[model samples]
Target: MEYGQPQASTGGSVVRAILSLLPDWVEWTVLSLIAAWLVSLGAVQVWRRIQYCRAVRAGRPIHAAAQYGQGRGADCLGSYAPPRRPDADGD
Candidate 1:
């Protein structure tokens, strides 16, 4: 009966209500699955970094974008090629 004010609950509340109806084990299982998935993704990234470093150290030609090295300024293990200027190649 209040004007310019919504009275119905949002979808988030409905989702929470449904989730509350689930068993504790179900919540734990979902949380564990999410954690495992995130950890696996991180592992894959670490592996890729290792391969990239090895390639750089071995003097192999890497087909990476010029901007890729700038973002990896410090966190990079050994070293990477510095990012090129946008107009350096006259692109």
Candidate 2:
């Protein structure tokens, strides 16, 4: 409140000073997690593109993928099979 004096402590400055105590790895961990998420997203896009190309070549109709897949899918049909029901389930 004095004409020429400045306040020694304020809430924002105190919070900023406290933030400097965090270790370097905390920042790297956050960055690493973000980078990992982005990399995985890019990988999924590339995979979908390859599968779409295959579908076009095979003439299965891309609309089948969109309609049945709700516009999204990752079915490697040739490499996997659906589960077969056991005879006991019929009893």
Candidate 3:
């Protein structure tokens, strides 16, 4: 209340200081997680491309869905009934 004297901060100043620091920590953690995810995605894409190139060089047609039996089921001619197992019910 004196002239030329600065006002002193109360207990709220400590709370404000802690609150301000919290955002910086949260921002850094989120940034690190996003960066890691992007790097992993890029690595997976490169690996897939390498595999595709290798398959092409081996004189075999590279069919992505071939592993799931896409065209191979045409011989059934609509008579295909999906195989059922008795244990599929988790009993």
Candidate 4:
């Protein structure tokens, strides 16, 4: 290459150019999605904390084996069961 010639585009320069062309709404949409995800995560944590507090107040065993299905599968608890999809099996 000649000394006066321009250099080829690097990965960083290409990415910066692409990002500069995106509309403002695209950035806002991404920020909104991130915010929603964070809020949902916080809500889940709060729900867990409330449940833990209730368990303590009710004198429930937090680590009891029976709570997690004793010696059988999780479905053995009867309170919780996974929904079966009709198309799960290739019947």
For each of the candidates, the C-alpha root-mean-square deviation to the true structure, in angstroms, is 12.8, 12.3, 14.3, 11.4
Model 4 has how many clashing residue pairs?
0
Give lDDT tens digits, candidate 3, residues 37-75.
999999999999999999999977787565543435544
Q: lDDT values of the candidates?
A: 0.75, 0.69, 0.73, 0.74
> Which ten-residue region of model 4 has the weakest summed lDDT?
66-75
Please list the residue runs of candidate 1 whose C-alpha ends up more than 4 Å from where it truly belongs after superposition.
Answer: 1-15, 64-91
TM-score of each model, paired residue for residue: 0.49, 0.47, 0.46, 0.48
Clashes of each: 0, 0, 0, 0
Q: What TM-score does model 1 achieve against the real structure? A: 0.49
Encode model 1's per-residue lDDT on 1-91: one tens digit a residue: 9899866678868867777888999977887998999999999999999999998999986656545335544335445656557776422
Better of 2 and 4 by lDDT: 4
User: Who wins the lDDT comparison?
Assistant: 1
Ranking by lDDT: 1, 4, 3, 2
Weakest 10 consecutive residues of candidate 2 by summed lDDT? 68-77
Model 4, 8-30: lDDT tens per residue? 67986896677678888986787
lDDT, residue 46, candidate 2: 100
Q: Tell me the RMSD of model 2 versus the true structure.
A: 12.3
